[model samples]
Target: MWQIILKRENEISLSRQLFYAMKDMILEGQIRSGEALPSSRGLAKDMSISRSTVNEAYDMLETEGYIVTHQGAPTRVKEGLYLEKHQKHHEEALFPVITLADKPYKVDFKTGQPDVSLFPRYVWNQMMYKSFEQLSDKDLGYFGTAGYESLRVEISHWLFRKRGLSAKPQDIFITSGTTQALSILVTMLSKAGLPFAVEDPCHRGLLEVIENSGNSILGISVDQEGMKTALLEAHDFSAVYVTPSHQFPLGSILTAERRIELIRLARQKKFYIIEDDYDSEFRYVGASVTPLYSMDKEQVLYTGSFSKTLYPALRIGFVILPPKLHSEWMYLRKHLDVQNPIVEQAALAEFLNQRKLDKYIQQISRMYEKKRKALTTSIYECFGEQCSILGDETGLHLVLKIPGAHFDEFFIEKCQNAGIRVFPIEHYCISKGNHMDQLMLGYGHLKVEEIQKSVSRLYNLIMDTE
Candidate 1:
């Protein structure tokens, strides 16, 4: 009799467990090739299981070619299936343990996280449920890579009404977010062995996309007006990446003269300008600045994201491409990720069509305005004219320039040990020593009480270091 045991009350079927155990033993070479298996009746009697269960397990093993049986003969293990045991040494392999959730911080000043508490979850859930109930069988199947057509049409109308930019639905290419849009663009547009020009101290993630793609980068300087286009005369580039509406980290609006100059340079040099109009909808000033795309549609690839205005988990963004690049972009997108989920796209289309996005942005804009005011006042009270704030007119975060103070790695560690979290401006720069005297503070996610306490703690940390 075979040494087979069966637990009849196990959650897994007895036949499945028996088949797995026998298969594993054969694969591991514990059961030698050509070894005869016991008969179902004998094994069943030894294991105290029904004869039918043992027969089913043996049937599976025979079906899988693990064992061979002839008419009225015993089952024998198949030969030549043993794999040599060459154990791989993973001693040199390094696995990263750091994750976003594991990041240690007390007063987190992380940027780009919207206040989730203010999100209209009830309305969003209703729309989502409605979309699911109304979805056709066609929606569940593989849609086109460009996106759901209804969403594209709705987005076109939304863009025209909100930003005054006339974008056709055919020209719009949907992506997961601004990051993926930029990533795909870098792959598609970058010329072989050519350098790209990017604004110095740009969003580090975007800059990384260019660098990791092996495209040489020309770091054009920027002042209060954004990306000094005068410096472009010296170097040739494949394209220029810019944040025109509201510059990243620095928050300087590109001037009209510079916008014209940039377009002229792009045409003269035969390169494109990537206009990242992120967070333009939340402008706290007079009117939303006209995107650089307005000056020349053909030369600019405009990208916009809903992460800031809407919840980040929405994972929706779009790129408005000119007619010439449209075909290539579509091809690249089809091969990369196939397409976004249809359910979210369908729901978002309904949301945009009903003008829910418009009302949502208006409500959140007022909340952010109040938060911005609270942060500004708190900083003034804590530092008392010793520190100056930069780029407070718009966006979720601002830079605090402490005169004669250098916030380096040493200072950052000390602040962390004291439970204060802030980013040094130098952390985002490609060239060191340029912005060592400033710290970046994100107040969008902080409440009035939390802002006051965090600012006071940060101010005290600076004083103690000095």
Candidate 2:
């Protein structure tokens, strides 16, 4: 008798279990070629299973070519099925586990992360539940390739009230986030073999997305007023990506004149512009700058996201495309992800309609403003005249420019070894050595006390290095 066992009580069916056992045996050479399988009735009696179970298992094995059966003859295992085990050197490589202590720093100045502790979870949860309960049958189904019409309407209103940018709901397309929106734009706008221009020390993630899509990228130099439009004029590109509201990492708002120049260039060159209006909702100073999209909706593609404002996991963002490009965007979006989750879209629309987003931004903006002040104060107390903080006016992070200090690979490794996680601006630069003296610090996630400690630690580390 074959050593076949079946457990009818297991989650897997008896037939599947039997098939697996038999297949394993055949593969291991236990059941050799031309070996006769026990007749179904006999095998079932021996294994204490129904005869039909055994028959089903045998039928599956035969159907899969694992075994061949001839009428009134043995079931033979397929020939040439055994795979020889190859002998090779197996080396266990030990990689160094990077710990914060290895760098030994008191303060971490990473940027872009928001303080999750400050989020109004209770209110958001209530909205989420309410929206879920009110969802219609049609809402559960694919609404449209564009987005939830209600959410689009609300976003249009939200942008106008918050950022002073007026956009039509018809022109808006929802995406997972700004990253996905930018990614789709890169694919949608890049003419055959044409290059897209981006800021030199731009957001590294956006740069990677454009490059990975096989689109050419021209890096334009960025000064205090954002991307030098003069540099852009000299270059020929299909599209130009700019952060007009507030430049990332460096924190410079694109000036009005340059904005006009960029729009003019795009119109003249027959190219498009991608305006990433991220983090502009948290501006503490002058009025939130008007998005470049307002200047010329025809040629500019404006992208915004809720990750920084609401929460990162929400994964809700949108793009404002011109009327001409709407059809192509819808086509690409249909194939990309089909559509975003309707529940969140419906909930977010309600949230905006109730003006909760405006209140939330006002609340977080105040909190962030305090954190930014604390960070600047801490840096001044520790570093004295030795260091200067850059771009402290806007955004969640600032650049600490230490004079005569070159933060190269050796310095970065040294900081990591000390438990301090600070990013060198050079790490973000496409062409290095230009920003070697600057370190990017994000204070949005750090408490006022943590900021003080981190700054003190960084100061001591810098002094020791000198």
Candidate 3:
């Protein structure tokens, strides 16, 4: 009799377990291909299982083409079912698999991280459930890759109301995030032997999207007004990438004059301007700055993400493409991921249609403003006159500059060893020797208590180092 044991107490049916056990044994060559299987009655008697259970297992095995039986012949494993036995290491996991969970940091101030605890998950979950229940059967099948149209229209409405940028629904297409948008953009914009003009000390993740795509980068220096638009040379780059609303890492808004200069340069050179309007919402001061895309939709290819405003795991963002690039973008998108999952898109569309997103932004914006204040106050208390905050206005994170304090690679390593995770502005720089006196502090995810304690610890660590 075949040595097949079934756990009656197990949640899975006995027949399923027996079938899988036998199938695996056959595949692993434990039972050779073409080997005769024990008769159902004999297996039942040997294993002490009911005859019906063994019969069901045998029937499944036969139905699946794993085994063949003639009216008068014994049930046997099919040819080519045998595979080499896989070697197992004792050091490797064999029992119930255990997965490692991320260890909680004593003080985590990671950038672009929103406070998920404050997100209106109950409402979102309800909307998600509703979308699932309300989505028609046809709506689930082969939906166009351009994204849910309702979501695109909602994004268009949001841009006008929130960012003061007017884009038609046709111009706005959904994306996973800025990363995917950039990934597709680099391919479309790349030209032979031409470099892309990117801000020096930009987000590392963004820098890679261009570099990893085999495109050369033109590292332009950034000052108080974001990328030094005055230094940008026309007819040189394929496209100029900028975070106009609020700069990344350095947190400076591109000046009105500079933005105009960039648009003119792009128009003259026949190049495009890739505007990454990351986290334009939640401005602490007056209104959020007008996006460069707002100036000229033809020249500026706009990208925006909800990673900061909503929870990051949502993985929803969008790009505004001019009519010229629509077909290629659709083709690329169709093959890329073939569109985002319909449920989340539908839920988000409902959320926007109902203005729950508006209410949520209002709630979280206040919390972040408070957190931003806590960080700045703690920094002042800790370092006093020694440090000054960089960047104009608002975002999730800002640059903390202690002018005299030298922060280098060794300093960063020391902090890591001390269980403190802090990123120096230099870490994100393409050209070195500048901004070494600064550290990037992201406070969006931190509570006031955590911010104060972490800033205090950070001060002591800096003091010890300097």
Q: Which predicted model would earn the best lDDT? A: 3
- Assess candidate 3 and give its TM-score to the true structure: 0.89
lDDT of 3 by residue, 1-466 (tens): 5566678899999999999999888888888888888888988889888999989998899899899999989988899977765456643556546778754666666787888888877999999999999888877987878889899999999888888789999989899988999999999999999999999988898788888999999889999888998788644987899998888889888899899899988988899999998887889998778888878999999999889888788889999999999999999888888888899999999999999899899998888889889999999999999789976368889889998888898998888777887889999999998988999988888887778899999999899998
| Cα lDDT of model 2 by residue, 1-466, tens digit | 5576778789999999999999888877788766777888988888888999989999999888888888878667888566544344332234444576534445566677788887778877888899989888888888798999999999999888887888999999999999899888888888877788888788889888988998877888788999999987676887899988778778888999999999898889999999998888887777677788888989888998998888888999999988899989989999999999988898899999999888888888899998888889988998789889877777788899988998888888888888888888888787777988888988887887677777888888888887
For lDDT, candidate 1 versus 2, the one ahead is 1
Task: List the candidates ranked by lDDT, beginning with the highest.
Answer: 3, 1, 2
The list of candidate 1 runs beyond 4 A from truth reads 1-10, 84-100
Rank order (by TM-score, best first): 1, 3, 2
Flag the better candidate by TM-score, 1 or 2.
Answer: 1
Give the Cα lDDT of each candidate: 0.86, 0.85, 0.88
Cand. 2 Cα-lDDT: 0.85
- Report backbone clashes per prediction: 0, 16, 0
Global CA lDDT of candidate 1, please? 0.86
- Candidate 3 residue spans exceeding 4 A from truth: 85-100, 129-137
